[model samples]
Target: MKEMCPNCKSNFAAKDINNINKNSIFIEKQCPSCNKWFCLNKTLTIIKIIGIFLLLITSLLNIFNIKSEYSPVFSSIGLVGILMAIIVTFFGKHETVK
Candidate 1:
Protein backbone atom coordinates (compact mmCIF):
# COMPACT_ATOMS: atom_id res chain seq x y z
CA MET A 1 0.00 0.00 0.00
CA LYS A 2 1.06 3.57 -0.62
CA GLU A 3 2.03 5.70 2.36
CA MET A 4 0.45 9.10 2.87
CA CYS A 5 2.41 12.01 4.15
CA PRO A 6 0.80 13.01 7.43
CA ASN A 7 1.38 16.70 6.81
CA CYS A 8 0.12 17.09 3.26
CA LYS A 9 -1.85 13.92 2.66
CA SER A 10 0.20 13.24 -0.42
CA ASN A 11 0.74 9.65 -1.39
CA PHE A 12 4.22 8.24 -1.26
CA ALA A 13 5.34 5.40 -3.47
CA ALA A 14 6.01 2.16 -1.66
CA LYS A 15 9.47 2.11 -3.16
CA ASP A 16 10.24 5.43 -1.53
CA ILE A 17 9.24 4.13 1.86
CA ASN A 18 11.18 0.92 1.27
CA ASN A 19 14.28 2.92 0.44
CA ILE A 20 14.30 4.55 3.86
CA ASN A 21 16.83 3.33 6.39
CA LYS A 22 15.02 0.86 8.58
CA ASN A 23 17.92 0.25 10.93
CA SER A 24 17.75 3.64 12.64
CA ILE A 25 14.71 4.24 14.78
CA PHE A 26 15.65 7.89 15.16
CA ILE A 27 15.57 8.62 11.44
CA GLU A 28 13.11 11.23 10.21
CA LYS A 29 11.55 11.50 6.78
CA GLN A 30 10.54 14.65 4.98
CA CYS A 31 7.27 14.83 3.14
CA PRO A 32 7.89 15.32 -0.55
CA SER A 33 4.95 17.63 -1.00
CA CYS A 34 5.15 19.79 2.13
CA ASN A 35 8.68 19.20 3.34
CA LYS A 36 7.41 18.59 6.87
CA TRP A 37 9.53 16.14 8.80
CA PHE A 38 7.90 13.00 10.15
CA CYS A 39 8.75 9.74 11.81
CA LEU A 40 6.93 6.56 12.74
CA ASN A 41 3.82 6.98 14.91
CA LYS A 42 3.99 6.25 18.64
CA THR A 43 2.70 2.72 18.37
CA LEU A 44 5.29 1.84 15.80
CA THR A 45 8.01 3.62 17.72
CA ILE A 46 7.18 1.62 20.81
CA ILE A 47 7.24 -1.61 18.83
CA LYS A 48 10.62 -0.75 17.42
CA ILE A 49 11.89 -0.01 20.89
CA ILE A 50 10.67 -3.30 22.25
CA GLY A 51 12.18 -5.12 19.30
CA ILE A 52 15.56 -3.57 19.93
CA PHE A 53 15.38 -4.41 23.59
CA LEU A 54 14.67 -8.04 22.80
CA LEU A 55 17.57 -8.18 20.41
CA LEU A 56 19.83 -6.66 23.01
CA ILE A 57 18.80 -9.19 25.61
CA THR A 58 19.51 -12.00 23.18
CA SER A 59 22.89 -10.56 22.32
CA LEU A 60 23.80 -10.27 25.97
CA LEU A 61 22.90 -13.89 26.51
CA ASN A 62 25.33 -14.88 23.80
CA ILE A 63 28.09 -12.52 24.90
CA PHE A 64 28.01 -13.75 28.51
CA ASN A 65 28.04 -17.36 27.40
CA ILE A 66 24.77 -18.12 29.05
CA LYS A 67 23.55 -21.49 27.86
CA SER A 68 20.21 -23.09 28.49
CA GLU A 69 17.62 -25.24 26.78
CA TYR A 70 15.64 -22.03 26.18
CA SER A 71 18.45 -20.42 24.20
CA PRO A 72 16.64 -21.15 20.95
CA VAL A 73 13.54 -19.48 22.28
CA PHE A 74 15.47 -16.34 23.15
CA SER A 75 17.10 -16.29 19.75
CA SER A 76 13.77 -16.71 18.04
CA ILE A 77 12.27 -13.87 20.03
CA GLY A 78 15.08 -11.61 18.96
CA LEU A 79 14.62 -12.60 15.33
CA VAL A 80 10.94 -11.92 15.56
CA GLY A 81 11.64 -8.50 17.02
CA ILE A 82 14.00 -7.63 14.24
CA LEU A 83 11.47 -8.77 11.66
CA MET A 84 8.69 -6.76 13.27
CA ALA A 85 10.81 -3.65 13.40
CA ILE A 86 11.71 -3.99 9.74
CA ILE A 87 8.16 -4.66 8.64
CA VAL A 88 6.72 -1.77 10.61
CA THR A 89 9.28 0.58 9.20
CA PHE A 90 7.61 0.24 5.84
CA PHE A 91 3.96 -0.20 6.83
CA GLY A 92 3.64 1.99 9.95
CA LYS A 93 1.95 5.34 10.10
CA HIS A 94 3.92 8.58 10.11
CA GLU A 95 3.70 11.27 12.74
CA THR A 96 5.25 14.67 13.04
CA VAL A 97 8.90 14.37 13.87
CA LYS A 98 9.57 14.37 17.58
Candidate 2:
Protein backbone atom coordinates (compact mmCIF):
# COMPACT_ATOMS: atom_id res chain seq x y z
CA MET A 1 0.00 0.00 0.00
CA LYS A 2 1.13 3.50 -0.83
CA GLU A 3 0.60 6.45 1.41
CA MET A 4 1.44 10.08 0.76
CA CYS A 5 3.37 11.75 3.48
CA PRO A 6 1.26 14.34 5.19
CA ASN A 7 4.36 16.45 5.76
CA CYS A 8 6.08 16.33 2.36
CA LYS A 9 3.46 14.77 0.06
CA SER A 10 5.92 12.05 -0.98
CA ASN A 11 4.56 8.53 -1.43
CA PHE A 12 6.12 5.50 0.26
CA ALA A 13 5.41 2.01 1.53
CA ALA A 14 4.72 1.41 5.20
CA LYS A 15 6.88 -0.94 7.25
CA ASP A 16 5.65 -2.99 10.18
CA ILE A 17 7.62 -4.11 13.22
CA ASN A 18 6.79 -5.90 16.44
CA ASN A 19 4.73 -3.93 18.94
CA ILE A 20 4.15 -4.37 22.68
CA ASN A 21 0.71 -5.91 22.23
CA LYS A 22 0.54 -9.67 21.70
CA ASN A 23 -2.15 -9.19 19.07
CA SER A 24 -1.18 -8.51 15.47
CA ILE A 25 -1.17 -4.79 14.86
CA PHE A 26 -0.27 -2.13 12.33
CA ILE A 27 2.42 0.49 12.74
CA GLU A 28 3.43 3.49 10.66
CA LYS A 29 6.72 3.90 8.85
CA GLN A 30 8.42 7.10 7.92
CA CYS A 31 8.54 7.96 4.26
CA PRO A 32 12.02 7.12 3.01
CA SER A 33 12.20 10.27 0.92
CA CYS A 34 10.30 12.69 3.10
CA ASN A 35 10.60 11.20 6.58
CA LYS A 36 6.91 11.40 7.31
CA TRP A 37 5.21 8.67 9.32
CA PHE A 38 2.27 6.94 7.67
CA CYS A 39 0.15 3.92 8.47
CA LEU A 40 0.98 0.59 6.78
CA ASN A 41 -1.87 -1.54 7.99
CA LYS A 42 -2.73 -3.05 4.58
CA THR A 43 0.86 -4.02 3.91
CA LEU A 44 1.14 -5.58 7.36
CA THR A 45 -1.94 -7.72 6.70
CA ILE A 46 -0.26 -9.24 3.66
CA ILE A 47 2.68 -10.26 5.77
CA LYS A 48 0.33 -11.77 8.33
CA ILE A 49 -1.35 -13.85 5.62
CA ILE A 50 1.98 -15.19 4.40
CA GLY A 51 2.98 -16.14 7.92
CA ILE A 52 -0.33 -17.91 8.45
CA PHE A 53 0.19 -19.92 5.26
CA LEU A 54 3.60 -21.04 6.45
CA LEU A 55 2.12 -22.15 9.74
CA LEU A 56 -0.56 -24.12 7.92
CA ILE A 57 2.04 -25.90 5.80
CA THR A 58 4.06 -26.86 8.85
CA SER A 59 0.96 -28.13 10.64
CA LEU A 60 0.03 -30.26 7.63
CA LEU A 61 3.46 -31.86 7.54
CA ASN A 62 3.21 -32.69 11.20
CA ILE A 63 -0.17 -34.34 10.64
CA PHE A 64 1.13 -36.54 7.83
CA ASN A 65 2.07 -40.23 8.39
CA ILE A 66 1.82 -39.99 12.14
CA LYS A 67 1.89 -43.30 14.02
CA SER A 68 -0.26 -41.96 16.80
CA GLU A 69 -3.82 -43.27 16.93
CA TYR A 70 -5.01 -39.69 17.48
CA SER A 71 -3.54 -38.51 14.18
CA PRO A 72 -6.97 -37.90 12.67
CA VAL A 73 -8.06 -35.79 15.59
CA PHE A 74 -4.83 -33.84 15.47
CA SER A 75 -5.25 -33.19 11.77
CA SER A 76 -8.80 -32.00 12.27
CA ILE A 77 -7.66 -29.62 14.97
CA GLY A 78 -4.93 -28.34 12.70
CA LEU A 79 -7.47 -27.67 9.96
CA VAL A 80 -9.58 -25.73 12.40
CA GLY A 81 -6.55 -23.75 13.49
CA ILE A 82 -5.83 -22.81 9.90
CA LEU A 83 -9.41 -21.67 9.45
CA MET A 84 -9.21 -19.53 12.54
CA ALA A 85 -6.00 -17.99 11.38
CA ILE A 86 -7.53 -17.06 8.06
CA ILE A 87 -10.52 -15.49 9.72
CA VAL A 88 -8.46 -13.49 12.17
CA THR A 89 -5.98 -12.33 9.58
CA PHE A 90 -8.33 -11.46 6.74
CA PHE A 91 -11.70 -10.79 8.28
CA GLY A 92 -10.84 -7.63 10.16
CA LYS A 93 -11.36 -3.93 9.75
CA HIS A 94 -8.60 -2.31 7.70
CA GLU A 95 -7.97 0.83 5.78
CA THR A 96 -5.39 1.84 3.21
CA VAL A 97 -4.26 5.41 3.68
CA LYS A 98 -4.14 6.44 0.06
Candidate 3:
Protein backbone atom coordinates (compact mmCIF):
# COMPACT_ATOMS: atom_id res chain seq x y z
CA MET A 1 0.00 0.00 0.00
CA LYS A 2 1.05 3.55 -0.79
CA GLU A 3 0.04 6.81 0.88
CA MET A 4 0.58 10.58 0.91
CA CYS A 5 2.37 12.50 3.60
CA PRO A 6 0.20 14.82 5.64
CA ASN A 7 2.97 17.40 5.78
CA CYS A 8 3.59 18.03 2.09
CA LYS A 9 0.96 15.64 0.69
CA SER A 10 3.11 13.87 -1.88
CA ASN A 11 2.25 10.37 -2.97
CA PHE A 12 4.49 7.59 -1.70
CA ALA A 13 5.79 5.72 -4.69
CA ALA A 14 7.15 2.18 -4.64
CA LYS A 15 10.56 3.48 -5.68
CA ASP A 16 10.56 5.69 -2.64
CA ILE A 17 10.32 2.62 -0.44
CA ASN A 18 13.82 1.65 -1.41
CA ASN A 19 16.40 1.65 1.41
CA ILE A 20 13.55 1.36 3.91
CA ASN A 21 12.86 -1.84 5.80
CA LYS A 22 9.65 -3.60 4.82
CA ASN A 23 9.57 -6.50 7.24
CA SER A 24 6.43 -5.09 8.83
CA ILE A 25 3.01 -4.79 7.26
CA PHE A 26 2.99 -1.01 7.21
CA ILE A 27 4.88 1.05 4.66
CA GLU A 28 6.94 4.06 5.67
CA LYS A 29 8.00 6.94 3.49
CA GLN A 30 9.76 10.26 3.77
CA CYS A 31 7.90 13.18 2.27
CA PRO A 32 9.77 14.75 -0.64
CA SER A 33 8.22 18.14 -0.10
CA CYS A 34 8.24 18.50 3.70
CA ASN A 35 11.01 16.02 4.41
CA LYS A 36 8.91 14.35 7.08
CA TRP A 37 8.44 10.60 7.40
CA PHE A 38 4.99 9.02 7.47
CA CYS A 39 3.44 5.56 7.40
CA LEU A 40 0.97 4.36 4.81
CA ASN A 41 -2.36 2.97 5.94
CA LYS A 42 -3.52 -0.35 4.56
CA THR A 43 -7.16 0.51 3.94
CA LEU A 44 -6.73 2.97 1.11
CA THR A 45 -4.70 0.56 -0.99
CA ILE A 46 -7.74 -0.56 -2.94
CA ILE A 47 -8.55 2.97 -3.98
CA LYS A 48 -4.95 3.50 -4.95
CA ILE A 49 -4.96 0.39 -7.12
CA ILE A 50 -8.17 1.35 -8.89
CA GLY A 51 -7.04 4.93 -9.39
CA ILE A 52 -3.73 3.92 -10.92
CA PHE A 53 -5.33 1.35 -13.17
CA LEU A 54 -7.77 3.88 -14.56
CA LEU A 55 -5.03 6.45 -14.90
CA LEU A 56 -2.99 3.97 -16.97
CA ILE A 57 -5.87 3.59 -19.40
CA THR A 58 -6.17 7.35 -19.77
CA SER A 59 -2.44 7.80 -20.14
CA LEU A 60 -2.29 5.20 -22.88
CA LEU A 61 -5.11 6.88 -24.78
CA ASN A 62 -3.42 10.25 -24.56
CA ILE A 63 -0.15 8.76 -25.77
CA PHE A 64 -1.80 7.19 -28.81
CA ASN A 65 -3.99 10.22 -29.56
CA ILE A 66 -7.10 8.16 -30.00
CA LYS A 67 -10.27 10.18 -30.71
CA SER A 68 -13.68 9.36 -32.09
CA GLU A 69 -17.33 9.32 -31.14
CA TYR A 70 -16.26 7.23 -28.14
CA SER A 71 -13.88 9.97 -27.10
CA PRO A 72 -16.30 11.19 -24.48
CA VAL A 73 -16.27 7.80 -22.81
CA PHE A 74 -12.51 7.83 -22.59
CA SER A 75 -12.61 11.44 -21.39
CA SER A 76 -15.05 10.49 -18.68
CA ILE A 77 -12.82 7.65 -17.58
CA GLY A 78 -9.91 10.03 -17.34
CA LEU A 79 -11.97 12.42 -15.26
CA VAL A 80 -12.98 9.59 -12.95
CA GLY A 81 -9.35 8.54 -12.58
CA ILE A 82 -8.41 12.11 -11.63
CA LEU A 83 -11.21 12.22 -9.10
CA MET A 84 -10.13 8.90 -7.61
CA ALA A 85 -6.57 10.13 -7.22
CA ILE A 86 -7.81 13.29 -5.55
CA ILE A 87 -9.87 11.29 -3.13
CA VAL A 88 -6.95 9.07 -2.28
CA THR A 89 -4.70 12.07 -1.84
CA PHE A 90 -7.06 14.07 0.36
CA PHE A 91 -9.54 11.70 1.95
CA GLY A 92 -7.73 8.38 2.31
CA LYS A 93 -6.42 7.71 5.79
CA HIS A 94 -2.63 8.06 6.12
CA GLU A 95 -0.53 8.23 9.23
CA THR A 96 1.44 11.41 9.74
CA VAL A 97 4.41 11.14 12.02
CA LYS A 98 4.20 13.39 15.00
Top candidate, metric TM-score: 1
List, residue by residue over 6-92, the lDDT tens digit for candidate 2: 556665453532222223355444556644444535655665565566567556666575556666665676666666556645454
Worst 10 residues of 1 by lDDT: 14-23
lDDT against the true structure, per candidate, is 0.76, 0.53, 0.67
lDDT of 1 by residue, 1-98 (tens): 57688888898775665324445655667666677777778788889888888888987886676886678888898899888888887778888764
Higher-ranked by lDDT: 1 or 2: 1
Work out the TM-score per prediction: 0.67, 0.35, 0.49
lDDT of 1 at 48: 84
lDDT of 3: 0.67
Top of the candidates by lDDT: 1
The candidate 3 region of ten consecutive residues with least summed lDDT is: 17-26
TM-score rank order:
1, 3, 2
Model 1 misplaced stretches (Cα beyond 4 Å): 1-3, 12-27
> Higher-lDDT candidate among 1 and 3?
1
**Residue 55, model 2, lDDT:** 60
Clashing pairs in 1: none
